[model samples]
Target: MSLNWITLRVRDLEASLNFYHDILGLPIERRFESRGKQIVMLGTGAQPKLELIQTIDQTLKPECGVSVGFEVKSLDEAIEYLKSRGIPVLRGPITPNPHLRFFYILDPDGFEVQLAEHS
Candidate 1:
């Protein structure tokens, strides 16, 4: 079976939207408000969508251990783009093997996001 979607509970919806949609350039597929909660779905093509939900009175801290990874066409280009945007890279641009390169960056809530390229 294919994966459906990944949901993340965000503390500040607007800031999260700016980070994901504006900075990272994930398009918003849809958004809705329900039960005093605001939710937004962002993604494109056939990949799994990312859902951001903001609930009233929610105060959950981001877990550092969990990480979401995205594949890129060029690791160097991706790293340059993030650096140009003033986004800090938390980890390596090291090659795990001759075929792969990766780096990590923290999201707005301090969630680890990995970008990798494979040859």
Candidate 2:
């Protein structure tokens, strides 16, 4: 089957929105409140690539060993932009090969986000 949207249970919807939408520039496809819960879908086109769900409990911890990766045009530029916004890079701009490079950063909810570039 084709891959569908990936969901993240976030502690703060507004903060997540700011990070993913305002900072990363992911457009909001749609958002709605249902059964006292907030859900927002974000992506570039008709189908949402990422979905953020508001957790009922703010103290719920995120699961470990999970990361979402985004392919970037330039790893250096991405790191610079993130640094300018005070977002810390948690790991390397490691080059496993001449054509590939990547780094990690934590989202507002402590989710590991990998930014990678491939030539």
Task: Output the number of the lDDT-best candidate.
Answer: 2
Model 2 weakest lDDT span, ten residues long: 56-65
User: In candidate 1, what are the lDDT values of residues 36-91, reduced to their tens digit?
Assistant: 79999999988899999985545676774777788899888988999998898999
Please give the CA lDDT of all the candidate structures.
0.87, 0.89
Q: Which stretches of candidate 2 lie over 4 Å from their true place?
A: 46-48
The C-alpha RMSD of each candidate to the native structure, in angstroms, is 1.6, 1.5
Candidate 1 ranges with C-alpha deviation above 4 Å: 56-59
Best by TM-score: 2
The Cα RMSD in angstroms, rounded to one decimal, for candidate 2 relative to the true structure is 1.5
Give the clash count for model 2: 0
Candidate 2 lDDT over residue span 26-84, tens digit each: 89988999898899989976453899999967776655677888889989999999999
